[model samples]
Target chain A: MAETAVAVHAPGAGEIARKRPYIPVFVILAVVTGIELAITQPGLPEIEHSLRIIVLVILSTIKASLVIAYYMHLRYEPRWLALIPLAGLALVAVLVTALTATVAHP
Target chain B: MAHPDSVDEGGEEHHGSPWPVVIAVGMGIGYVGIVSASIPILVVGAAVFAAGAGGWVHVDMERPSRAFYGLAAAIESRFPRVSARKLALWLFLVTEIMFFSAIIGASWTLRLRTTTPGAAFQAPWARPGEILNVLLTGANTFILICSSVTMVEALAAIERGDQRKVRYFLLATLLLGITFLSIQAFEYQKLYFGDGLTFTQVPAHASEVNKLYGPTFYAQTGVHGSHVTAGVLALAYVTRKAFKGGFTKDNHEAVELVGLYWHFVDVVWIFLFTIVYLI
Candidate 1:
């Protein structure tokens, strides 16, 4: 009887496994893009130049994270797989640093 | 030939093919042409590459099941279950990260140096939203994001062995990708001819903007647009295969692999939209 019951439960398990939070993620992405467009429009509270830049950077980062973690299925993949891109980002960091230094002094 | 060596009863290893070599050689030639700035040499390389690619795609579509499927299945049994193709693609993506970094970093450096007071360049970067069709590009960004969702769903559908849904979703993804490229082409046309942003020029109204702006904008977004064009071609290939009932639940690595590339493009655009448009 237990074996038969286990067989009966197996079909439902497949459904549970395939479920992913895709639509909610899309909603969040669209909403964020809307906010990005809104915040950059011509007439608003004159945000400090630096603060506006910071906010845009942060928002873009959040949007990027959502797409990578969800759309790319990186969240579900092995954690070590992320190290590949991070390796390239390590170089990017150096480039950004060098560029900033040049800009500050040049 | 279904010879014993190529066909393991267990279907494990692939003595892959030589066509990829031809493709690589063509790309190598193209790279050389780029360095030399010779249009004829570049065109020849591109033609050869296209032929090689077309032949490879033809072979895959004709016999997608036997060699590729067995290889994918054999390699998927190991840790993480990613096929060798997927691993190779991820590695390729890493290189793309560095490539984009170079383009974007150089552009940003140029912008900064030009705009800085007492700097060498004559003018600043045009202000945000000044010379760009931000609203149109923003809509294009949304289109790309939507395509990403459709692409993921196509993979999901294939995983479920729903061939109809796979075909539908792939077709949807292909259409969305084409829409993106069309909008980009339109934007390029407008920016170049209508708005006076060409290789060595900017709008007269924005005469204070640096001359480097046009080249940098085209370089960053042009490379990205080319990537999207490649993605669309990939999508078309897979969509054709999916329509032919080529992928089943147990053997759809092509779908997944294409999804990986598509999503990677979306990820790049996510940042590109911010860096180029909003910032």
Candidate 2:
């Protein structure tokens, strides 16, 4: 009776019990961070400045997405809940665009 | 009538408190004070905010950290449901996303405008590792990432009713969070005093760097450090409660909420380490 009550009130409790790739995600984040440091080091074969920036941004985005998807459990959550952060990102896109325009023109 | 804090059929407590409103009022006043540059008003706002936080903590300290899903169920029967607190937390995170964006956006704008030629403050930006300690901050980033793993592991432990593992993981996470903050504090001290990176001036070593560099660097990393401090405090609270057995397998939403916040902070640092340090 108690178990049924809990299951009714708390949906997805079982799904959360399933094992996740916490260690693997951590390894990816750490490795990517190391790559970021390596690429930016002064003695490394000088990558073009613009290319470095693009690569760093892509790498950081990957790290952020992994953290959000696994550590924050957005991947396991209801699809709609993911929309909350995406909505914020949409606004961020707008802001970045505006800021980019300002910098390009001025 | 049933007492307002009475338990329902599912053994969930139902109650309302005024502390959230008080906190909001305090924050509203604090925002006003900031805009107007009123010191006394700001102090008053801080006092109110502190009081509200203290009162809420005191009220909740003895209660088991439980989920309130009654309203969620009644409101939505067709769609998949989440706990009210979790939904609210995600919404709060959305606002945080916008908040950090604005801060980063403004800093980037300043950097672009001042560093470009024929601009009002045309000065060169500092090269990577010229004025800052990227190596030290990179290590701190690793510490934060470790904390995120422990935080999730803690949640996973509690979900399995492994009370001992939950306590141990929470303790480990708390220690890792404290270490991250300590490293950041050390970095800030060294940067501010040893390197002369003040709000108004660049490091003496990097004299040719734009004056705005100091302010922008501190603003971005300092704001992030402040968020980490808040995360540490939240972790401390949850850790204390977990030690007191204030959570159970079915009623550990607080752990998940705090984990979400901790990971969010970690996610922010991933970008910040790249943007502020590596780039």
Candidate 3:
């Protein structure tokens, strides 16, 4: 039940697990999310449609990169590891573009 | 003892949790019930699912199962390539991206085509903050963001061998996940019962808007909610293992992977908020 404690200082592994300041990133996320909400109010439907889509997509990408880099330890792992998931993403992009095009026309 | 420091491919044993199977059975039955329109079967399925989930949690709380310590990790070096799991997850995410793109793209297409007057089945998109409780959902979004931070911090703590912080951050993340879901449940309750949104029907007063709103709302949010639920279950298992002294600075891959999943879920929500509520 206390695997976290074990992982923390397990005899000789503490060198890897250390603390860092994450508050700033959290703050950025909060501010961006707030902006997303603010710009999406009713009176600005015309403005909300395109602008909201762009900002939200950007914000989510940023958030995903942070998690992948820090939490998933992709930064520390062999660089080759990154390519594995990237390949998957590339395929997904193709699928999406194809499907979206079909939906739009059909 | 096997050289404790020497990393083996399969360093630990994974006694897979039975709860997942139980939950699956419950869902299967519930699905059948829905199709059959059998109230008792549905209720029974739900009860079994709940019981299985409760038992699984109880088991996890008891202790982390022994690690499988599969030799796959050692064998991974033979390929001298990208770690298999990381590659697999990325591939999975890519598919997920497409899945979401389809949903969002379809919605956008509807918004554009229908907004034109006299178009077949013409109706306007819901204005921002018109149908949704924007402020409340925004707050929930904020909560999800915080959980993402906590999840990353937990991984960082594991990296530094700070067991206490790892536990603290993971626990914090678990709570934040619950809070976000609670807010969503509240939102759904208000929308379905209070605001008259249902799967196949819209409120009497909402005719000016496209009828697609109900299905879209449920599709996007329902999928996200299921992801949150999965994250919660993963956290619970990891937390139990943390309590059992399972992970070590060198062997905490489980925590990191789960954090990745949690973050991915958060990323999904960020887009979801934008598309469903904001746009």
CA lDDT scores, all candidates in order:
0.80, 0.86, 0.71
Calculate candidate 1's fnat.
Answer: 0.51
Query: How high a TM-score does candidate 2 get?
Result: 0.93
Q: lDDT by residue for model 1 over B94-125, one digit each (tens)?
A: 88988888899898888877777787765877
Query: B192-257, model 3: which lDDT tens digit per residue?
Result: 999888876677667577887888888888888998999998998887677666665556767866
Off by over 4 Å in 3: A1-21, A42-52, B1-95, B109-113, B116-118, B201-206
Which model scores highest in lDDT? 2
Top DockQ model: 2
State residue A50's C-alpha deviation in candidate 3, in Å: 3.3
Those runs of model 2 whose alpha carbons end farther than 4 Å from true positions after fitting are: A1-5, A9-18, B1-12, B75-77
Could you list the CA RMSD of all candidates, in the order they appear? 4.9, 2.6, 5.5
- What TM-score number comes out for model 1? 0.90
lDDT of 1: 0.80
Model 2 sits at a Cα RMSD from the real structure of 2.6
A8-32 in candidate 3: lDDT tens per residue?
2244434444433367667777877
Error of 2 at B4 (Å): 8.3
lDDT of 2 by residue, B77-165 (tens): 56577777888888999899998999989998998899888999699988899988888888888899999998998998888777898
Model 1 residue B235 lDDT score? 98
Better model by DockQ: candidate 2 vs candidate 3:
2
